[model samples]
Target: MELKWTDTLDIAIELDEAHPDVDPQYIRFTDLHRWVTELEGFNDDPERSNEKILEAIQMTWIEEKD
Candidate 1:
């Protein structure tokens, strides 16, 4: 499925799988933003994301890692 900024949970899961060694809690928003955009099937406008959306994705990723 195509991923959008609103797909925080799904994006997190994908990130968790893509970078199993990563600790999402410590990820910078810049890196997170790049990673999300690089994800397979991610087709949303990169410019559409903001701090709040990045935070949600990070939080969900942290949860998924746990």
Candidate 2:
């Protein structure tokens, strides 16, 4: 699936699957941004993301972890 900044859940799942050992709650936004952009099928503008969007993605990722 092609991912965008709005695809928070999918992105979260991808991240969770890719980095199962890492805790989403403790991740830095900078690292998150880089990881999101690096994800396969991620086809959105990297510059489109901001703190709020990243927070949403992180929150979703946390939920996915549980």
Candidate 3:
């Protein structure tokens, strides 16, 4: 089945969010695009790193699960 992104979750699951001490710096669009292309085989993929992007933006809901 083809994968399609929906706004079911506020934070996208495909992205990788980063939380650091310094001010948050989102991943470059080029890098993100490449990663998405490699993973999903799409160059203009938005979901790519979006969840992480959201996490980088606001990491609150995610819990520390082991």
Highest TM-score, which number?
Answer: 2
Deviation of model 2 at 32, angstroms: 0.1
Q: Note the clash tally of each candidate.
A: 0, 0, 6
Please provide TM-scores, in order, for all candidate models, with all chains considered together. 0.97, 0.98, 0.30
For model 3, the stretches where C-alpha displacement exceeds 4 angstroms are 4-11, 17-25, 40-66
lDDT of 2 by residue, 14-45 (tens): 99999999999999999999999999999999
Per-model C-alpha lDDT, please? 0.94, 0.97, 0.35
> What 10-residue stretch in candidate 1 is worst by lDDT?
57-66
For model 3, residues 10-63, the per-residue Cα lDDT tens digits are 222333322222222444546534433444423334644465444442232233
Error of 3 at 29 (Å): 0.6
Candidate 3 local lDDT, residue 42 = 31
| Residue 47 local lDDT, model 1 | 97
Best-to-worst ranking by TM-score? 2, 1, 3
For residue 61, model 3's alpha carbon misses the true position, in angstroms, by: 13
TM match of model 1 to true structure:
0.97
- Which should have the higher lDDT, number 2 or number 3? 2
